[model samples]
Every structure is written in structure tokens, then in C-alpha cells.
Target chain A: MSSVYVHFFSVSLDGFGTGEGLSREEPFGHAGERLHEWIFVTRGWKEGGSGGVDDAFVQRHDMGIGAEIMGAGKFGYPGWENDPDWKGWWGPNPPFHTPTFVLTHHTRPSIEMEGGTTFHFRDTSPAEALEEARAAAGGQHIRIGGGAKTIRSFLAERLIDHMHVAVVPILLGRGERLWDGQEGLERDYAIESVSSPSGVTHLTFTRR
Target chain B: MSSVYVHFFSVSLDGFGTGEGLSREEPFGHAGERLHEWIFVTRGWKEGGSGGVDDAFVQRHDMGIGAEIMGAGKFGYPGWENDPDWKGWWGPNPPFHTPTFVLTHHTRPSIEMEGGTTFHFRDTSPAEALEEARAAAGGQHIRIGGGAKTIRSFLAERLIDHMHVAVVPILLGRGERLWDGQEGLERDYAIESVSSPSGVTHLTFTRR
Candidate 1:
């Protein structure tokens, strides 16, 4: 069965997901970078195209994912303004050679990238996006890439099947947190996997 | 001294930001659009940009920000991984004519745009980026544009001068939350403003 999973997401010491000031140049902003300090050093990230990566966790993250789902913020707000001629920050041949789906309000024409990548925007709704995503996966797995709010939306509907988090040893003290006021979750999730290298704890949780 | 604030970020009723698969195209995913539903409607947004933008909150957010910040996820992962031809998601003369700062780990060249816009990447820490932001504002305020974890960083540290949230009437049981488990802060902040317009509660909190 196709399931929703939050993968490759990094957390801060104070439980922040990202840092402030999400600039393309400095996307994580302050602690945002620190949150991913653990993952960036992981081998999983290095294998995934993050240059000169370190640690074994990064290796795990890059290998086990087949596809990605991200929010408009993940694409850059400037990209959406005035419906201008902007592709994304990643440029043409984005790192994700795999198929990607976007959830947006203003509809856009489908954008196909090199390396077997096609960006399809769905405003139909989450359920609709999920259906389309399942069909689009082509038997490969789908990793739900989040921008905080995006992740919360799917988790609320209880549609997520698994979540992979790289718990780094740092704190944002603000920006976005991991479990800030999330209501009515089963709370009893089993750890599917765990890896420890460079003090970053990689945890995979599956629905109970 | 320049201060950072997390303004107009939204969350769903279910606590999720968007629904399901995430992509650069639909970074916010599902109802993630609802988060910014208020900002675009603000008097500021309407009076400045297109005419008679419906929502009041959105208009205000659009009216203008001191300066904007970007996170890695918000900017798009797979850094510099572009065709080298495409730019960002926004068109020329973007909504923000102000100088913007990017939070990044990789030290790349700065990206300059038209309309007094220049994208500067900070390989330093978030505080260092804030220093640059303060200088760039030249007396104006600084906005901590978020992706989730970015916002959390500021919140946990209580580095924010003010936080204005447009609580959309929706929920995303997952993703990220504005305020998670940030400890060691003065909780006695004052509620500076509150409104329930367009089924969204516009709340402003200021440090004591």
C-alpha cells in the first residue's frame, strides 16, 4: 500500500525544523543550518549530492528514498510571485531526477526537468494530490518533503505512513518546531530504524 | 539594533501546513495556501500590488516587509543544481524590491537581480546573517520568512521582536508547527493584536 512519509527532515536541539529568514542564499537561516548540521554531515546527504558530506546518516537518507513532495515554500516564494518566469532555486536539472509533485493554489503548467523529473502542480486538494502521486510514483516510493506547514497538513489527516528525522545536536530557539501544538495524534509510533554517527540520531517511525 | 520577526505565517486547523506530497512547485502542499490567505488580503498587499485584493490580512503582509529571509528548503534543495540558464521562481521586478539574504552552507557567489534586489548567501551563522540583514534594512524592519524550522529557530531563541500569525481555519496533523518545544524563554509575552477576519485569526504577540 502507498503511504505518506516525512523523510530527510532535520530537527534542531530546541525542536525546530528550520531557521528564520528562508532566503534562497541562506535557506535555513541561523539555526536552520544548525538543524541540518547532523544530516549534512551524514553520508546519506553526501550520496544525495550535498557536496563533501560526512557521517553515515546522510548516506542512509539519500539511498532509501525514491521520490519527493515539497511545498511552494520549498520552491521559493519568489518563484510564485506574479506568476513570473521562474523555475526554482535548484535551477533546471534539479537534484531530484525522480518525479516530483507540488501542491499549489494557482495552477501552473507541468514542468518536466532533465534526469527523469517532471513537476506537476495539483490544486485539486490533498486527497487529489495523493491519488495523483500514487499513480505517478510508478512503483517507486514517495518521500513527503516538507516546509513545516506542508508536513502538518498531511499529518493532520493521518495519511502519513512513516517519518524519517535526523535529530541534530543543535537548537534554533525559534523558527519552526517539530511537535508544536500538534493535536490528536496516536502518539504510539514504532521506531522502524535508527542510526548514530556524529551525534546525529536518525529515527524512522512507522504508524502503530 | 535590528530585530527579526516571524510575521503572517499560517497553520492549518489540523496542524498540517499542506496535504500530502511535497514538491518545489507545491511547496506548501494542500491547504498550505490558506496560511498566506490573510497576508495577500491585507490593505498593504492590495494597495501596493494588484488592486482590491480580497483579504485584509494578505493585503497588509503584501503592503511591505522590512526585508525577507530565506531558508534552504524554502530556496529549494540541490543547491546550484540548475541548468545554469533558469533563474528563480519569481519573474523580474519581484514583489520584494528590498535586499534579501539567503541562509546557506555552500559558499557560492551572490545573485543580484533588478529593482534593488540582490541575493546574498551567508556561509556564516544565522546571527551573522541577521547582522547583514540589519545593515541592509538601513532602519527598516527585518522579516524572518519561514519554511517552519527557520521560524522555530527564531521563536526558540526569542530573538523575534514580534510575531504575527494569520491562523487559517484548517489543520494539518503533521509537517511543522510555528512553536514546538522551545524552552528557557520568558513566556509572559503580551498579545499586541488580535482579529478574526475571513475566518482567520490574526494574532500579534510582542516580547515583554
Candidate 2:
């Protein structure tokens, strides 16, 4: 069976996946790029960057990922659905080179982008969305791409099989938190943690 | 000037310092010692236990601390004030071998315990309480013992000079959160993290 995975998802020390006021101009809102600065300094993001533990873990983001299911918040900015020509934050060739399903209320026609990435809109439950993404996964693993709420919903339902969360040391006082309603999440998964030299702790949770 | 420190403060992965339904029987509430199980097996707590990273950190709880200022919640149960005979959760010889100040709206006369630990109740702000604890500290650092709200208040005022938080990899869906309203706290502190082999990440914050 193909595993459901969440890789390299970053959250602030206070558990905020994204900061307040997320807009097209500031995709991460008040958090800015602080939540993901650990990745920016890794060899996976830039050449000649540190290829230490952080790079070792971040570089695994694309391994065996066949399809992705992301929230509407991650598909684009807050009012992105109103704009007809908004492709995505990622330029022409997005990092996700798979059939990416965007969970949105306003379902639009599928837009095929360059580099094997196709945006498919779906307004459905997490279980339903996972089933659809599973069918499109072609026997490979499915990646649960998040802006925070999407991952929390899947976690609440115990859908994720493997997850890697990079906990940034900074605190984004106010924003959408990732662990709000996940009370007994530890019951289903065996968790492990490792801190990096860049001051971020990588947490991996594998289903028991 | 004496520095204020918070040592061996434990919180769930979701940032809950203590669980819900806090009462006399369930001191940590539904958390039920879950948040503190890491220290229970440490050599600091037991005679024959692991003396690794977790033990090394837990043993520092009383290091160089002349006085302690804790919240009312940490001192006793919710309605302990109503009962005139209520002393504290700890036995006659409490772990704190110094003058400990309890911040409570219902102030009481000082109680001298078996050990050097003397309970002094004060209804004052975090700064004023620190001033009293500082004087009582006799040039040694003052410890900010917590139950979450007290530590958050001290942190909000930037009164704590150092903090060591043990992040346990469990989610207590509902409880008192430690990180709420503490946005951009990293600006005031230099933070570092180390993941212990026993599955807890120890985070140390030094005032910048």
C-alpha cells in the first residue's frame, strides 16, 4: 500500500505553520520567511549551502512522491480564486511534479502546468480527497502538502502514515497553529526527534 | 544583578504545560504525569535510572537557585486556599531547599517546611515578585517555577534570563498552553535545541 506522508513541513516554536495576514505580497504573512529559513540555508535550496543534517532531511522531500493533496490556502494566496490567471506561488515549473489536488470550495477546471504538475481542484472531505489522490498516486506515496489546517485535519483523522516536521526555533506569536486539536495523536504514531546545527528540530512520526 | 531562570520546565509537543481538569487527585489533570514521565526514569528522580541527557538536564532544577517564584497553580490545587490546612503537593521535605514564593491573589502567612523550603505567598506582578525573590535569592539566580500561565506571564515581561524547556513528543489536545500570546519571543532570547535519546527535545533559551 502507498503511504501517506508529510515531508519537510515547517512550524514555529509556538506551532504556527504559517503567520497571520497571508497574502500574495507576503505569502507567509507576519511570519515572513522565518519559518522556512532553515531550508533556505541548506544545500537542497542553494548551491554551496550547508549539506549537513538539515540538508540530508530536506532533500528527502521529493523521494517517491507520486501525488500531492494541499489545502486551498497553499494552492494560492487568500483571494487567489477570484483571480482567473493566478497560476500559483511557484513559477512556471512548481516543485511538485505530480498530479496535485487542491482542496478548495470553488472548484475550477484542471490546469496542466509545465514539468508534469497539474492542478486539480476538489472540494471534499479528507478521506475522500485521500482516496482520489491515492488513485492518482499510481502505487507511489501521497504527500499531504500543507499550509497548517490541511495537515491538522488529516492528522486529526489519523490519515498520515509518515510525517517529517521541521520545528523552527522562532515564535510567530499569532498565526494558524498546527497542533491545535490533535490531543491524542501520539497514540497512533511513534515519534522521534533530532536537532540540527541550524537550530531547527526535525520531528518524524511513523504510524505504529 | 541576579538573573531569573526557568529550569526543567516540561511541555507537550502541542505546547500544553499541564492538562485539563486539574484537581487535587489529578495534579497534572488528564496529562496525569505524562508530560513529566521523562524525568521520572532519570537518575535525578530515582536511584537506579538513566543518567543521560534527560537526567543531566533534570538534575539542574535546583542548581544555583536561591529562591523560586511559582504560580498559584503550581503551589497547590485549585481550592487549596479554601482549606486552611492545605500545604503543597510536595511532602514535608519539599524538593525546593530555598525560600519559595507563591504568586496568588489569596495571600497567606509564611509556612516553614521541614527542609529549607519556606512557602511565602504574595499577590504581586511578575516584576515586583521578581524583586522580592531577587532579594531573597541572596545574589544567586531566582528560579521561575511554572504551571504554564506563570511562566508565560514572566516571559511576556521579558523577566526570565534563562529557560530550559523539555518538549515531550505528545499532544494534549486541551490544556493550558505555554506559547500563547508569546509572539516573536525569539527576538529577546538566543535559543538552542538538543534532542535526547529518550525522545525529548531540550530547548535552552538565553537572554540576548
Candidate 3:
């Protein structure tokens, strides 16, 4: 069975996945790259970066991922629908070399990028979107690419099979929290944590 | 110089220090003892318990602490002020063997208990309370005993010199959050994290 996984999701120590005041100029808002700065220095992101525990976890982002389901917030800025020229934050050849489904109320025609990645806009529920992504996954695992709220929605429905969240040391104070409305979420999964030398704690939750 | 510290403070993965619906029967409220079950198994809490990394952290709760300042919620249940006979949740001999200041709007006369513990109710600001506690500490380090909101207040004022927070795997969706109003708190502290074999991540933030 193909499992639904959320990989390389970074959250602040205060439980915020992304900071407030998100705009086209600041994708992470006031949070900047503090949440993801650890990954940038890892070998998984850079060629000759540190190949320690941080890299070991960041390298798992692309392992056996067939398709991705992302929220509209991640697909583009707040009013991205208004701008018809929004191809996505990623340039021509996006990183996701698979069928990426964008959950947006404003559904548009599918756009096939330079790479094997094809952006499919869908206006459906999390479960419904997962079913479509699963079909496109073709026996491989489906990745839930998030902007925080998207992952929380999937997690709220208990649709995530496995999740890896890197707890950054910074406190965003004001932002979209990842753990909101996720009360008693530990009951459904077996959780494990590992702290890295780079001062980030990697938490893995596997469905029981 | 005597430093202020928060030792063995437990927070859920969602960053909630204490659960919601606090009452006389349940001290930790809906969270019950889920946030502290890890400490119960440690040798610091019980004899013949596991003496591993978890115990090492828990044992620090009583080290070099002359006085404690806690929130009124932690001293007793809501409406506890009405009951003059209500001593405290702890028996005649409280665990704190020092002068403990309870921050409450309804100030009352000080009560002396066994084991050298004295409960002093003070309706004052965090800084003012800290000054009184410091006087009672007698050059010894003061510990910040918390229910969540109290710690956040101290943190906001940048009065805390050191803090140790145990990040439990559970999620308390509704409760008093410890990280609220503490935006960009990581800038002031040199933070480090270590994951224990008992499945708890111990985070230490030392003032830089």
C-alpha cells in the first residue's frame, strides 16, 4: 500500500510552520528562512554541505515520492489566482518531478512544466484529493507538500501515514501554527525524536 | 549573582504547558499527567526508577533553588480563594522546601508549612514578584515554578536566565500556551536540545 507522507516540514519552537505577513516578496513572511536555514546548509540541499544528521533527514524529501498535494497558499501568493501568469514559486523546471495537485477553490487548467511535474488545480476535500493523488502515484508513496494549513487539514482528517517535522529553535510569535486543532494527535501515531548537532530536533510520526 | 531558572517545565508538542479545564481534582487539567508521565518513571520522582537522561533532567528541579515564584493557577484550583481551609494540592509538607511566592490577584497572609516551605501570596507584576522572591532566596538561585502563563510573562520581560523545557509527544489542543507573546525569543538565549531514550526531548535555553 502506498503511504501518504509529509517530509521536511519545518516548524518553530512555538509550533508555527510559517510566520505571519506572508507576501510575494517574503514567502515565509517575517520568519524569513530561519525555519529552513538548517536544511540549506545540509548536503541534501548543497553539494558540499554538512553530511551529518541534518542532511540525513533532509535527504529523505525525495525518497520514493510519486506525487504531491499542496495547498493554494504554497502554490502561490495570497492573490495568486488574480494573476494568471503565476506559474508557482518554483521556476520553469520545478523540484517536484511528479503530478503535483494544488488544492484551490479557484481551479484552473492543468499546466505541464518543463520537468515531469504537472500542476493540477483541484477544488476538493483532503480525502478526495488524496484519492486522486494516490491514483496518479502509481504504487509509489504520495507526498503532502504543505504551507502549514494544508498539512494540518490532512493531519486533522488522519490522512497522513508518516510525517517528519523539524522543530526549529526560533519562536515566530505570530504565524500560522502547525499544531492548531490537533489535540491528542499522538494517539494515532508512534512518534520518535532525534536532536541534531545543528540545534534542530527532527520528529517522526508513523501511523500505528 | 543569583540567576532565575525554570527547571523541568513540560510542554506538549504543540507548545502548551498546561491543559485546559483546570479544576480541584485535576491539577494538570485535561492533560492529566500525560505531560509528566516521563518524570514519574525517572529516578528523580520515584525510588528505583530509571536513572537515565530523563532522570538527570528531572533531578535538576531541586538543585540550588532557594525560592520559587509560581502562578496562582498552580498554587490551587480556581475559586480556591473562597476556601480559607484549602491549604494546597500538596499535603501538609509541600515538595518545595523553600519560600514559594504565588502570583495571584487576591493576595492573602503568608502560610508556613512543613519541610521549610512557605506560601506567600503576592499580587504584583513579574518583576516586582521576582524582587521579593530574590530577597527571600538569600543569594541562592530562584526557580520559576509555572502553570504556563507565569513562565511566559517572565520570558517576555527577559528576566529568566536559564530554562529547561521537556517537549512531550502529546498534543494539548486547548490549554495555556507557554510560547505566546514570546516572539523572537531565541535571539536572547543560546539554545541546545538533546533527545532522551525515554522518548522526550529536553531543551535548554541559557541566556547569552
Candidate 4:
């Protein structure tokens, strides 16, 4: 079976997965840009062909993934208004070129990229995203691409197989909450790996 | 004079903030509970203590402070360790004791909570900790109480004016990263604040 995974989630030193005021004009809100500065300089990003790439890579394959689940905010507004020129934040070739499932209230047609990556905008429950992800995993791991809430829902349900984090040193002092109001995730998790180079430190954990 | 304030300092959500070799026998490593996860729920902690306290307040204010900075590893350490008791997973009274700062060689912190709260820890140089904080505030903001790297240096720099945080999260994620690898605080300081609410979120950031 394809397991679910939350790989490469970057956060401020404080505990925020993303900055606030996620709108078209300013997606990450104030000080949001600084959150990923460490990761943008990572060797994996530069080599992984991820435009927004940085140096914060913990390991190339320690995370072990299979599929992808992203939120609309990570892809910008889902409306037809999302400019074609507004390529998702990942730049020309996003980080995941696999079968990417995007979570949105609205709907958009499936989008295919140069790599094996295909972004399918779905307006269904998170379970649906996992279901589709399982098929795409091809016996690998189902990855949860994020926007905080999307990853959170999976975590609350204990659907995450493991969570990989690239923590950078910076604080906006205000914005969104990562685990706020989150129904506690029962059955604790355990760390299984760690690595650090420049800019960021990477870590991995499995459900205990 | 500029005052350095540490913020919501805690272990890498993976349960190890103290570094390697932390065993179940010594969770929290040397940094332990005193190092993290006991401030969020503490008494002096306020999303906006500047608002002044009252019995009517609903949000957890005792943990509230003013400015904060943190290192990259302060949030999540995805490494395998022997300490199963080390539940670095934050539940309450996290080692923050205030709206804090997190220093990163990179990245930024962004998250605001109920009582006029905000957490911004990223790319912040220690030199900026005090000056930037004072200019951004209406009144004196408490510096986060403890976290080896965060607190020890302040003592050496003599930048901290006050300190407070609870000690309840328990020990497990341990080894040693507290007094070591850090310089000594040259100035003599006093505990200006202290409170033990239900003995859960200790109140330390208040009296001083």
C-alpha cells in the first residue's frame, strides 16, 4: 500500500509552516519570504530542478515518497483568474513532477508538466486526495505537499507516514499558526533521521 | 541599551533539541524541560500582556512575552534517538514563556495567536534582537526564559533584562547542549518572575 508522507515542510523557528495573509497580491504575507530562504539555497533544490530550490536538503531519499497532495494556496487562487504567467511558486519545473493532487474549493482541469508531474485540481475531501495518491504511489509513499491546513488534516487523522522538516532560522513575529486548534494527533511519533549542512537542518519522524 | 529576547524555544518537533545521544534516561537532553515546552501555558505568557491582565481573559496569556529569536534546530529534529520518553511534540507550556524570537542562519517565523500575539523567528541576527524589538513595541516585552543557546548567550551578552518559563514538559530528549558550546553570562541577573500554575506552565517570565 502507498503510505502518506509530509516531506520538505519548512517552518519559521517559532512553529509556523507558512506566513499569513495568503492572497494573490501577497501569498505568504509579511516576512513570508524569509521563511524559505534557507531551503532555497539547498543543493537538492539546485540539482532537483526545483526553481524555488535552496540548500536545505537533509537527504536525497531518506524521506522515501510516492505521491503528492497540495493545497490551492500553494498553487495560488484556483479561479480561472490565476494568471497562466503565474506559474506555481515552484517555478517552471516544480519540485514534484509526479501525480500532484491539489486541494481546492473550486475546480480546474488537470494540468500536465514536462516531468512525470501532473497537477489534478480536486474538490473533494482529504480522504479523496489520499485515495488518488495511493494509486499514484505505485507502491511507494504518498506525499502530502502542503499549505499548513492540508498537512494538518492528514496529521490529525494520523494519515502521515512520516514528516520531513527543513527548519530555517527566522521569525516574522506574526502570521498563521501551524498546529493551532489542531485536534491533537494521538499516538506519538518518533524521529528516525537528521542531517544539516548550510542554511537549514533537516529531520524525519515516523509514527511511534 | 538593546535587550535580546529569546522566543518560543523548543526541541526540533522530532523530540531532540539538545543534540545527539539523548536517551530515554535523560530526555530533553541537558536543555530538557527547562530548555523548552513549558512556557506556552505558563502564567505570565500572554499573546498581549501589554493589554494588561484580567480574570476575564480567555487566551493563555501567561506564556506571552514580547520579542523572540531562535536557531534553526529549535523546531524539529528528524533524527533517531534512544529516548522514547522524549515527547518533544508540543502540547502545552511549551518552552516559550513569551511571544519570542528565533534566530536562523536563515528563514523567518510567522504565527499570531489569540491575545494580540505574533511569533517571528528567522534570519534575525542577535545584534538585531534588542533594537528591532524595542522599536516594534508599545511597552517592555518579556524575553523568552530559557533554551540553552538562547538563554546562555544572553547572559554573556548581558542583553536580557528579564527571564521566566515553566518546567513541566518532563525530561527525555537529552544528552548535553546546555552549558556546553556556549559562553558564560558575564553579568549577574535575578529571576524577576515566577509562578507555578497547577504546576503545568510554570510562571517565570513575570516577576522580573
Per-candidate clashes, comma-separated: 118, 2, 0, 83
Which clashing pairs does model 2 show?
Answer: A173-B183, A183-B173
Q: What is the lDDT of residue A91 in candidate 2?
A: 92
Residue lDDT tens for model 2, B1-208: 7889999899999999999999999999999999889999999999999999999998887668899999999999899989898889899999888999999999989999997999999999999999999899999989999979999999999999999999999999888999999887888999999999999999999999
lDDT of 1 at B131: 74
- Candidate 3 runs further than 4 Å off: none
Candidate 4 on A1-208: residue-level lDDT in tens? 5567776787653446766555666677754566666555545645653333233343443455667888877777434335655556665577685788888776777777776777888888888779887887788777787877787777777778777766544434455545443322323665432324333445455777
For model 1, the stretches where C-alpha displacement exceeds 4 angstroms are A46-56, A62-66, A184-188, A192-197, B1-208
Model 1 over residues A140-183: C-alpha lDDT tens digits? 66777887767767766666788776655443566765555554
Q: In model 3, how large is the Cα lDDT of residue A34?
A: 93
Enumerate the candidates' DockQ scores in order. Answer: 0.04, 0.91, 0.90, 0.04
Could you give candidate 1's per-residue lDDT for residues B31-119 as a string of tens digits?
Answer: 44656655665556556543332254454454345677776656553443353433455666655677777676754566678887777
Please tell me how candidate 4 rates in CAPRI terms: incorrect
lDDT of 3 by residue, B6-72 (tens): 9989999998888988899888889999998999998888899999989988887776888999999
lDDT of 4 by residue, B43-158 (tens): 35545332222111213433334544544344434342233232233434454434545554544435454444355555655557656666655465545344466565554555
List TM-score per model, in order. 0.47, 0.98, 0.98, 0.49
lDDT of 2 by residue, A32-114 (tens): 99888889888998998999999999788877889999999998999999999988889999989999999999989998999
**Model 4 regions lying over 4 Å from their true place:** A23-26, A47-65, A77-87, A90-93, A182-186, A192-201, B1-208
